[model samples]
Target: MHSINIHNKSGHDQTFEVHGWANNQNITVKAGQTSKIPAPDGSSGAIIALHEGHEGEQVEITKNGYGGNDFFDVSNIVGAGGNITAMQVGDQSTLKGDPHFMQDMNAAWHKASQDTRNKLKGFVFTNGQGKVTRIGPIKDSPELEKLVRTFANGKAYVGVGAWNGNPGNPDDNAQSSAGHGNKDILITYNDGDASPDLASPKRESRVAAFEVQRVQVAAAPPAPPANGPGIILTNKSKQECTYFFYGNYWNGNGTAGANFDKPMKNVTLAAGAKSHIPLPTTFKGRVQRGTELPATWVEFQISASNDGAAHGDISLEQGCDGAATIASTDGTNRKNGFANDVLKDAPAAACAKKPNGTKAIATTVGNWAAGPNQAAIDYLKKVVGQKKAYIVGGTGTDDVASKNKCLAVDMY
Candidate 1:
């Protein structure tokens, strides 16, 4: 039998059905596709039947594949004895009924595929230390270039060692010197993990770097991670926002208690993007909150259209966008007890029980639904779910104040 291969170089996808030849079935090939089909027994060469209907349309076997609207059936007419055999077909439209004509066409398709596979492809750079430095069209980078130069004189194979699909854009339909843009540059090293752990297994023992040899031109390097020393702040709101994280000083010397407060990490969160804002690591530990001046609490000022701040002490101004009440690691019996109070494990220790030491009683003050802090509360919850959050305040008590020190509490 002969060999017929089909490659879809067009931008769109095409489907074909095989009937009366070798197999009877339909296959949809996306743009830049390739497939092969052999001729059936008792058939000289194969017949290429073509029709004008859209792909995947069910057609009669007579006028579909073997007996389509047009037929290029050349059987038992080629190099060997009269045996009805079909070789292969890349494009049935190019089939010729002549003896060697169809066979030559098949050979040409094979050659074209070979040429594509043989081209010098793209490069993927990885450090000898198992770090992927770069991928895609080759570009210059200090770290990657240095690594390449160091390995070039050593065990790294510089030329065509083997043929494989390019990893970066392996299935890209765009025609390139490499078939389907799938060729790889495998850089081996003399050193690597011989035995890796079960949880974190290694792929190859000595593969230090892997570069995909690409026929396409390289583009610019990708942007690096956002620079700074803080929690990455993301803005999912449509409008921009100016945020200020207030220091833990809710019960101290008026607003001046902000002295212990951090230098505001004011960040503008663009809609649908994230930015970084630093928070002191100290905020993760235990905290205390009571009816003292300048209670130790975490606070943040958020200003979008209006400005408001949420504290770890379950306090927020009228404009406070949102809040969340966190229970102590060990829930308490009293609704306002330090264990069961609004403040548990808070970082601040400034506020302490005074004249009415045990006189304080824990009580549930704010309802999330009726309160204005629900938005901020939901946001913190989402961030935590993403594993991007850490607990801040950890201790507090239920103290009834004529005017609540805070209207809402935001976890961030």
Candidate 2:
């Protein structure tokens, strides 16, 4: 009568033996159900679930949901169950095993569930001159035949509008060409019928059949680039960026020398530029932008490292505006697919902890991982007017031969 404190998470009506309460022998909590027990004198009790094979799940109950939990609703509670009742299940840990508390994690779940469950089944209809005609099948029906005749070129543009099922579809639009397995409605039209009197009923199947006997074609993977497997990095950023790639191949523990630790690799990228890098499947690295420490970077891996799914994480370890992306095709399938990116559909803080070492990457084949090709000017001004004077290098780029083009990253 006060608030629903005891809940039955079982599959049937569970009678719980009430203890430490007056004039109450048993409390029946329906399967996946909850109930309120009014304690006029303000009493407390424990309810032992009388469920088959589950007699051990005992729950404690109180007038006000105890232990700082608000199974009790104030002004802050929201939807479905709230509209059904006014109670709220704020912190469920207090009433941990209460079936009804936070039963629907999302408040709109109940209404959304009911709507999905009560969806209309498959129905067919014809619309001609602002009128919806036929309700069922089309064969031998004069109404549909007449509807088709009204349209121009004796051709009716069949737009299969509404298709509904329990969860299978309403997810995807009804496709133009039929036979995709979900729900297909193909409209066949003819000026004449297959009556017993006619020598032959003209049932013309639409679209070109075999245009094959004419010349057949089979589906194949996309054509690979003239160069071996590799990734194409495009610089779409307005500002010039210096990009770097360092492999994960570990050496002892040095930075620049032939010892270990120090790693570096980078190329200049003008505002709008593109570069393709041919790498090995054994290549594991980091692709980043900027010249100094703490620049924009993302962990990029687009090739099959596991011989299956290639994964790339948006390592916000260093930050990016989130537009950087690494996309590539499969070596085995030769199909263009799999794009790993930052910011676009990914959240900033979502991808935490990511890599790339310093300029030692040149001597180091791979340290962090890999970026693009564009002549981005170094931040250091080389003109004679400034204080720290240094001679400008003629051009910057190194040729590194790699086997098996395994990755590509796009930094925008």
Most TM-score-accurate candidate: 2
Instruction: Give a tens-digit lDDT track for model 2, residues 1-412.
Output: 3333444444555565666464557777565555655442123444444423223223333222111111111110111111011112331111111122222222222233434323311222223552222122222333322222232111111122122212211211111111111111111111121011111233233111110011111133334445455456667777777776655322111100110122355678788887776655443445666432223444333343223223232222222333444433433332221233323433322222222332211100011111100111122121111121111211121111112334455665
User: What does candidate 1's lDDT look like per residue over 8-50, in tens digits?
Assistant: 4435555554554455666555655555555332122222222
Model 2 poorest ten-residue lDDT run: 74-83
Residue 112 alpha-carbon offset, candidate 2, angstroms: 80
Local distance difference test values of all predictions, in order: 0.25, 0.30
User: Which stretches of candidate 2 lie above 4 Å from their native place?
Assistant: 1-222, 249-261, 291-293, 301-305, 308-313, 330-407
